[model samples]
Target: MKVKIDLEKCYKAGECYYNHPELFKMGEDGFPVVLHEEISDESLIKHANEAIEVCPAVAISLED
Candidate 1:
């Protein structure tokens, strides 16, 4: 799965970071940063989904 983050819509909520720190991180500007572009492994997908679900701003998504 391909993961994308809409930085413009992000409000620096940091939920993604809390849910999946390996896949998502906070930048120096306090915005969400995507650590990976694609997650094909099942284990990684689980973490990615967690990040998407926990994002309060709805800034994270799993794309085709």
Candidate 2:
């Protein structure tokens, strides 16, 4: 899976970070900073899906 976050669509809600800190981190400005953009592992997909669900800005996305 490939993951991406649109900065223009992000409003610094930080839910994505909270849901998947291993791959998503909150910057000093409180916006999400993508730590990993390409995900091939099965375990991380679970967190990625949850992050997508909790992101208020809807900035997180996953592509197969």
**Any residue pairs clashing in model 1, and if so which?**
none
Ten consecutive residues with minimal summed lDDT in candidate 2? 12-21
| Model 1 lDDT per residue over 1-64, tens place | 7889898888888888877888878888998778887778898888888878778888888987
What digit string (tens of lDDT, one per residue) describes model 2 on residues 1-64?
A: 8888889999987788876789888888887888876888888988888888888888888987
Model 1 ranges with Cα > 4 A deviation: none
Question: lDDT scores for all predictions?
Answer: 0.83, 0.84
